[model samples]
Target: MSMVGNPVQVGRRPLDVDLIDRARAGDDHAFASLLGPIVASGYRLAGAMLHDRYAAEDVVQEASLKAWRSLRQLRAGAEMRPWFLGIVANECRSVRRTRWWSVLKFPDVESPAMPPDDPHTTFAELRRGIRRLRHRRRLMLVLHWYLDLPMAEIAVITRSSEDAVKSEVSRAMRQLRGLIGVEDA
Candidate 1:
């Protein structure tokens, strides 16, 4: 069953206890309801990490299966966002490990170069900088910036302390800036 649907508000409303109970009782729609908004973030997170739409889709699909299989193991009062996102992140890592070479992006030396200040050029440079980062740092950067997740939440997902998550995000930013180089104003 495809759980795709319009994203609803998240991070605001509390988890629906009724929905969780229904899902745990083997109700597919209840599970889908629980996943509705969270899956959107999972899809985006996978897409940014994998840099391939189809691969990201596959990762999310696999993660959803993993999540469904383990729903019974979810402890009462546990937050679903971090749990599901962690699963998606793990799946992305697995995919990257299995097919590492296919995701690498080399410079298109043969193509005509764009102007230095062009938005496309800047974005391409940013992407290259992100790719050069270590996997963990890259995930931190994407999660904090691209996904707009708080350091506290990222800490939970990464199984690290909040201070560690903050330090990593700061270091990732510095490293990315160094890789991208600074513009003298």
Candidate 2:
């Protein structure tokens, strides 16, 4: 499945209880099928986090494996997207901490689609400014703005309260604007 398109909308998409049960019971096919949509979203999340397609792929792959191994840890009927994304986010963070992450000069991460034009700068320039953000701030922006995930879902991934997530996103945007040299107007 292509990891670039058709992200599942959280509330709009219904969870398949049967699929979850079978996957939780150790059915590989069921797990793969269930994880397909989530993985695509996870890939986007990882891509934004790691800034390298190969590293994003590796991070998502590792996250998928971790998700599979920890499937039992998922609460019954819990939303899988946030939970799996949390794993993916953690994997990206872990990869960034390793020595190899800095030795390589990975290409800049480009978003799948053109973002809305900013009067002050191009999207690519904006992305460069985003790169200057701290890891947690970057993760917040990626999860909240890039993924179009709701605050509650982002909260789950960040392990913060919804209010805290909201506050961080707002602060991150301000920091991004500052980094991009956009004066408050």
Candidate 3:
């Protein structure tokens, strides 16, 4: 889904703040409720980044499990979205590393047959091109463009300077544009 398609909530009420507070205090139900909104977004981010359903599912699952286990480690008043997404990105890197090791020993399988007119298939090609990028570049591109994360947060997540993040994003976008044949990717 595009950024325009996702709903935005403007302000939080007191109850919502209480829920976050309770969730941080090890309340399972509140944590579950807190996770509800992020689950689909997490899946989308992982799917777009990894370009494989199984890998994306595993990434999200691992991230979610880790988040549940370490909920209390999340400091009070911290923004949950970027923090959780950082976890997902970490899991994605793990999945990519394992896949890279496997691919060293075996070739990747061909795509299953799909109708020529399928837009989904076209999008899959774009995602495949993303997967072809180097790890840091791919992570930078996905987090910046696909997830609409700010450069500061991306730098924190990727453990780079904001200038380095900007440089990688620029380089990745150029490569992606060449692959996708567009001025913008």
**Model 1 error, position 183 (Å):** 6.6
Clashing pairs in 3: none
* Best candidate (score: TM-score): 1
Local accuracy by lDDT, each model: 0.81, 0.82, 0.74
Instruction: Encode model 3's per-residue lDDT on 1-185: one tens digit a residue.
Output: 22232232211212255665566687889887777777776897789777778878988989989988887766555556666777898888787778574485434465787896788777776766786788778888878887787898788667689999999999988897778666762
Poorest 10 consecutive residues of model 1 by lDDT? 1-10
| lDDT at 65, model 1 | 91
After TM-score superposition, what is the CA distance of residue 66 in candidate 1 from its true location, in Å? 0.6
Candidate 1 per-residue lDDT over residues 1-185, each given as its tens digit: 32223222234445656666678888999899888879999999999997889989999999999988898866656667887888999998888788464567555443369888888888888888897888789899988999999888898789899999999988888889889996423
TM-score of 3: 0.70
Which residue pairs in model 2 clash with each other?
none
Question: Global lDDT for candidate 2?
Answer: 0.82
TM-score, every prediction? 0.85, 0.83, 0.70
Give me candidate 1's TM-score against the actual structure: 0.85
Candidate 1 local distance difference test against the native: 0.81
